[model samples]
Target: MNIEDIKQRITGFSNELYPFAHALIPEELQAQQLVIDGISFLFADKDCKTRLFDLLEVTEHEFVNKEFFDLKKVSIKVIYALAKKRFTQLESGLDINQFGVFYRLGLSARAALFLKYKFGFDADEVSEILSLSRIEVMTLTHESRSHMVDFIRPVQEGLQQ
Candidate 1:
């Protein structure tokens, strides 16, 4: 493959990965660093795609096991996961925290919604990235909506009473 082709691929991947990494890690510098590392790794390996996938698998397992939750570590993990996948389309939405709806949700629920709604990833993609089952991703999405309802219900009740 042409070196230019590889550079283009890395750029596209960074766009797809950056928002999710920033959102999940809540540290912009750390998130950016991870993406940089991913790009560097991509350039260094001939079989970059496979290498990225292997890194993602390791990251996913660590996330699921709750073994690496530090912002920098999680940022690196998420970047590797994002690099491994290819997103065919690009979409945009406000950040999850910016929407003021996800603050009280659990991390899993927030990540599920962010990947699904914000990034337009399907159940399978989100499942792979987060190392959750499709069912788990679905459940997380549903629970996030439920949590939003719960958060708003009291205001509705107050207004009615």
Candidate 2:
């Protein structure tokens, strides 16, 4: 693929994962930053899916604002090498909102949900990416599904909205 094409694909895929990012951070701006930084740093040589898993695994202390790998060309590197942007606003905490509910889940559990439901990876694939056994992925998926229902359902008159 051409340089532009690959960048475009990466950006598009990153946007598709924004909701997951937002849920992970519970702040729209920080989530956007994750996507932006991810696009800037993706290695063309590395598998995109594995890179994405690495991204989610990055803790705040591990975040690198600069690009390291360009898939190879300096031209490709230049295209994605935009200045890093940071949002200084106070990020939201876990509350009753959809994002908050999602944030309450352990990071691995949340990743398991997004990997399976959002990205359509089967348990085997998720296990490989997450470094968990197949059984653990299955269990995480099951528990995450059970938790999702309460927050996802419509609020009845008698229940808390």
User: Best lDDT goes to which candidate?
Assistant: 1
TM-score for all models, in order of appearance = 0.58, 0.56
Query: Where's the lowest-lDDT run of ten residues in candidate 1?
Result: 85-94
- Displacement of the residue 129 alpha carbon in candidate 2, Å: 2.8
Candidate 2 at residue 13, lDDT?
A: 50
lDDT of 2 by residue, 18-85 (tens): 66555445566766766565555455435644554454445443242221122222222222222112
Best by TM-score: 1
How many pairs collide in each candidate, listed in order? 0, 1
Task: Show model 2 residue runs off by greater than 4 Å.
Answer: 44-100, 150-161
Model 1 clash pairs are: none
Model 1 segments beyond 4 Å from truth? 41-99
